[model samples]
Target: MYKRVLLKLSGEFLSGDSGFGISPDTTADLARLVTGALGGTGVELAVVIGGGNLWRGARNGKGMDPATADYIGMLGTVMNAMALQDAMEATGQPTRVMTAIQMHAVAEPYIRRRAMRHLEKGRVVIFGGGNGAPFFTTDTTATLRALEIGADVVLMAKNQVDGVYDSDPRKNPDAVRLDHLSHREVVERRLEVMDATALTLCMDKGLPIVVFDLFQEGNLRRLLTGERVGTLIES
Candidate 1:
């Protein structure tokens, strides 16, 4: 269903059993799942990872200066990016970590054209550092990259949940799960699936997004094969 995809993974998802920081085993599992989906297939992937496991610019540093807190959060994302890149490489998948901020020693600077070329050659590119500026979320970055790369869909690999619901399903057991929704519905309902800016960007670009549980084994493969296992946000 999709020749190219942009995968958005929250940093918390990488925290294996401990629920904080990068867990080698968990990252390895995710890498294996991603490679399994793309291996022997001509699918291209670009990954955008969040830093919530380490630090969230808004939630952390309540007393600290906003800029300092955001910078710390960006660094956290770089750390996760490196870990994911290593895990993917260990699984025999070619990967690259590109940062919005210039970090020549650790990653390449974000260049849309070069990233597209890498994808074209079957290399998975992981974008980190969240627009290299304060206030913009990684969700927005994922949407922007998806449009730049002409991805068929954005696979929002969430932790511990499958699909979008009218309310937090964990809290409200009776929350209705939505199999399909329009971007406008997400915005109008104020669903916290993604930031409003990100949702609007996808809406404007006409990019579909599939919000699914990354922890579910083989769910990524099912999504790539066009299985309607998650909430699809489209026109």
Candidate 2:
């Protein structure tokens, strides 16, 4: 069981069936679920959300420069962070949105000590903007924050997949799911569970990661309760 956990949620998951932009209803539902899981447990929570639903750096601007595209993606993540913070607060949960880039009017500049203080007080902290630089993914940010904040585990919430598989489960009916793995094995096998940098960081820090299907009812709660419902990667 984790005393503190960092949840990594992709922005696309917030979009629901629309596949783009934030869906208030869906986000509200997610907020309820998160609050339910956190209620009375006193588990410290931090979140990192992706921006694929709004814009993906790799797919933006078509022929535009890569740096420009990535910047747009970073902006998109900030957008999601603000929305998620609002939704969480609406559910009566005190939440803070911290950005790697200093956007004072929009979010607090990321300060490690302040974030840890928020966690100690049971506030949900949402880290956004993807490292505030180009060529780095939110996955890496999640890993970095998890280690920096001394999180007990990182819960990776996938859209539908339950765990890491040898192959794409959608494409291969026979794809094998791994219930457990070592950090070394995940990297050596080239599994797509997390980005290479994130994987390496977890490995170095001996951080445990849980990969689970976020769409499954009560799975997040189960994960927080220490129920083994998905694959776990550990050192």
Q: Which numbered prediction scores highest in TM-score against the true structure?
A: 2
Candidate 1 structure, TM-score to reference? 0.95
lDDT at position 111, candidate 2: 95
Report RMSD for candidate 1.
1.3
- Which residue pairs show collisions in model 2? none
Q: Which regions of candidate 2 fall more than 4 Å away from where they truly are?
A: none
Cα lDDT for residue 224, model 1? 76
> Against the true structure, candidate 2 has what lDDT?
0.90
Q: What tens digits encode model 2's per-residue C-alpha lDDT throughout 95-183?
A: 99999988999999999999999999989999988787888889999999998899999999987799999999999999999999999
How does each model score on TM-score? 0.95, 0.96
**lDDT tens digits by residue: candidate 1, 9-68:** 889878987878889898888788888877876788899999988998677889989988
